[model samples]
Target: MKKLLLAGVTIAMMATPAIAQTYKFAVVPKAMNNPFFDVARDGCLKRAKELGNVECIYKGPIEHEPATQAQIIQDFITQKVDGLAISVADVASMTKSIEAATAAGIPVITFDADAPGSKRIAYIGTNNKDFGLALGKQLLQLRPEGGKYAMVSGGPGAKNLAERVDGVREALKGSKWVEVQGSPTFCNDDSTLAVQQMSDLRTATPDLAAIVPVGGWPMFAPEGFKAFVNKNKKDIDSGKLTLVVADTLKMQLELLRDGYSNALTGQRPFEMGEKSMDTLLAIKKGQKVPEVIYTGLDLVTKDNVAQLLK
Candidate 1:
């Protein structure tokens, strides 16, 4: 009888689960190949290290396929990660997956690009409309007497890009000199595609005044930048075309110095990662986090571009 009782007690103790001390959080991006996302991952990992009791998992789709992002989120769900920070590629397609994550009792927050209608706890990135408004403001400074300008962007249906385009139009509303040439061209986040579109547009409208890319997709490919410089150098030199782009990554600063682009808009991607982790952790702890969080932006120009280079 004594031996039987002791064996039963030992079995019960062994079956009891140990207390969980470390947490795992997953950070999902629009695409894994972009260097911009790598910066954001650095921020997320830095925050995870600072917390000392958390692990950050970074993953994303290889391309911008509609199902890839949603599928990755579902995989994270299956892994049962403690929290998720995502930059959704498509809002409508992702809503159900985001809601499913929420329903699974996992905390979800969005960074960079937000799915506003989803159940995401908070948004941590630039206010994209304001981002566009600022870009338009800089364009005016470059060409206050603008003749005709064109915009290059990621996806036409992308929420963030659309907002920025709208802001650009709004900013140029009262100005008679500036005219947005046509509907913003969508490059689908392909730098090569962006280069082709810009080349085609310039060919069609030889007197195209300015080329403003809502995102610096094309500049990511050195060949694309080289093509732009080679093809448009004369126009740029003659002040017939001004190139202003968003996202002042290191490559962009180099482009500014080499006179390939006129200006760049910088976003705090590091902060996007750090704050996103902090917000997701807070939500998991049943603490309150604001519904919207706006990271800072910087306008990089030749006059002050040297500061960012360092």
Candidate 2:
């Protein structure tokens, strides 16, 4: 009887499935202060909980500093994380760190912003050039007989923003719209500086017909952006000046409804975060994955802002 009982216990143990290995996936965003990235962080955490074996470590510089961001990546590599997903702050700087991680036998992927020259396994984010084209087209639709416009971008070294700028230019090619001299002022991800630059650009070029921000930097600061919009209310209402900014955050949507912006082009940062983990897990399991995974974009205007809010 004792021998039969022992045999039954051994069979039961053998039939039970072994626990899966837990993966520690780190998601490095451009900055921790940006509310836009907060959504991404939520997505990462949600997906990690769903997976039950993925530990998502979301960390980055307090602000948009390439050097600081690179240091964070180095620290993660030293910690020997199972996989890494980064939104590249500076393409060149991030590429070096990504290559080092790959050499260390760790899988690496990029999201939000990409470093195409790097040895990273895959990129999961928006096709920024297309995002820019959409921004330009939105502006054109608002003020089709374009006059003068200036672009506002986050970081000067950001590959994503540069592509969007180029795309906007491409979309405006042969159109009446002309980019103002000394346009595309870089705010370096500072919301205050972004609003100031907008004011300064408008002051410098009185005939500036449109202001296109490839990213919604100023919109992050609701009161300040509201004040700026209120100051420019006459122009915006008269259609003499148009504002087409990127991202459809809650605050941005509110501003759009309040007539602060003409149009908005949004990226799915949350989806980027969720998919970053999914892609990294597949790579860790040696499964096939695509080189580029575009999360898609949202073009928001007064027409859809109400429904999106709900």
Candidate 3:
């Protein structure tokens, strides 16, 4: 993320308006306020300034919602922005708005999350399925027998979450465990939601050996599942429950250190933001660009966290 964000700072400086560039750009993330994209947003701003005439803006729903994000995209179209960078909140619902953006002669390139059916020029992000596969492999390594594991997905049907979970399913197909139960929880980027979901999932499945949350809200929520644990400290302290997940929150990394979480699937959000800016610049200057650029993925665990955190 540092490298990518720094690259944006440099690019924004070098790609000044004197270079025949004037653009109004916008990026929509899953939500408006998360440290993950807070870093990315900083990069976007730096690039916008360095490009001189370039004006960049970012808008996202207070929580992760496709309808709100789609509205933001339409608003960008009405404003006639040169380019739209969307990190889709819901893949299916955002398709039409994306189509409209292109129809208005505005190019769209999606980052972290995606609207696959839309006519975006390119997608700059990780191969989410591969990320899920990596998560499953790590879980297996931790518990080779692969006992019944439960998932607390951030949202019921979010595309990126679904993809990572699908990858986990594919990897676990031959393993010796049937999914006893799981629920799609919504933290809505709020700690209260975490409290609610934790209470709900504990009520839903009491016997899950491991609980995995592939979504950031649940995996990183400050008080996630703690309510249930507070009531059942004996259950948790007795080592009856285990956990696994993918995310980049520093607290989650700490949990990894304490053995509460086995691993994390990291998406280079800063890289995505920086590279997306680079992609837009290439297109503006009439340079060829790849239709899809993989930003890459990382698996961070207790054993490797020291190196990864460094």
Candidate 4:
């Protein structure tokens, strides 16, 4: 009887399940102000829930400040999170923090914006150069007759936006359809400032045939969004102006619907957020991931806008 009791106890102990390991992944965006990052956060949260035992902590500075972003990274490092994914606001400033995270045995990855020189394992976001080329192509399709254009962009120092602008110039090389009007008007990722800049551009170049905003700042605000479309409504209707920008969020899609915009190049920000976390988890598990993961882009026009909306 004693032997049988001991055997039953051993069986019970052997049948017990092991506790699941929990991973904490921190997702730091360039700024928390933009709706784009909000969508990205949603993706991260959804994926985190789907991937049980993994917690995704999405955070960033309210403004586009490199120092602020760096501090956040540092805090996360101190907290000893399992891994980190960042969309660096400033490449130069954030490199040190990224290196520090890696030095401490934490894996880091970038999305939306990248710090390519850092020790990050992978970059997951749109190919900015190709994105610009696609924008150039859309411009050509909109108006084949050469005309003037301007770029409303984010920070001048942002490497990704600069790359897109360079690609735009390359695509327009020797082209008769359009010519760059002036230096890029930096919006600084402020929605109000974006509207003001657009208004100023319209005033300075009433003949502005095409406007390409590398990042969709104004469209994040109801007022800014309405103002950009309403102000350009006449020109768009008369075929005198062509507005094209990066990002295809629902509001931008509406602009495409209302004829206020000629074309909108969309980024897979949701996938960026989702994959960033997943990649970090894989890295934590000692699984190898790619150095660069391209999320892909989509061109939304009047034709297929409905499909996307539905």
- Judging by lDDT against the true structure, name the best candidate: 2
Candidate 1 vs candidate 4: the lDDT winner is: 1
Q: Per-residue lDDT tens digits of candidate 2, residues 162-274?
A: 99999999999999999998889999888888999999999999888999988989999888898898999998899999999999988899899888998999999999989
Count clashing residue pairs in model 3: 2
Q: Would you list the clashing residue pairs of candidate 2?
A: none
How well does candidate 1 score on lDDT at residue 237? 83
lDDT of 4 by residue, 164-248 (tens): 8887777777888555556488877887887788778878888888778888886777567677778678887888888888898
Write candidate 1's Cα lDDT for 36-135 as tens digits. 8888999999999999788999999876665888899999999999999988788887788889999998889989998898898889999999999999
Model 2 CA lDDT for position 206: 89
Q: For each candidate, what is the lDDT?
A: 0.85, 0.92, 0.71, 0.84
Error of 4 at 296 (Å): 0.8
Candidates arranged by lDDT, highest first: 2, 1, 4, 3
Error of 1 at 179 (Å): 4.6
lDDT of 1: 0.85
Q: Could you tell me every candidate's TM-score relative to the true structure?
A: 0.91, 0.95, 0.84, 0.94
**Candidate 3 collision pairs:** 12-50, 246-265
Clashes of each: 0, 0, 2, 1
Candidate 2, superposed: residue stretches over 4 Å from native: 1-16
Ranking, TM-score, top scorer first: 2, 4, 1, 3
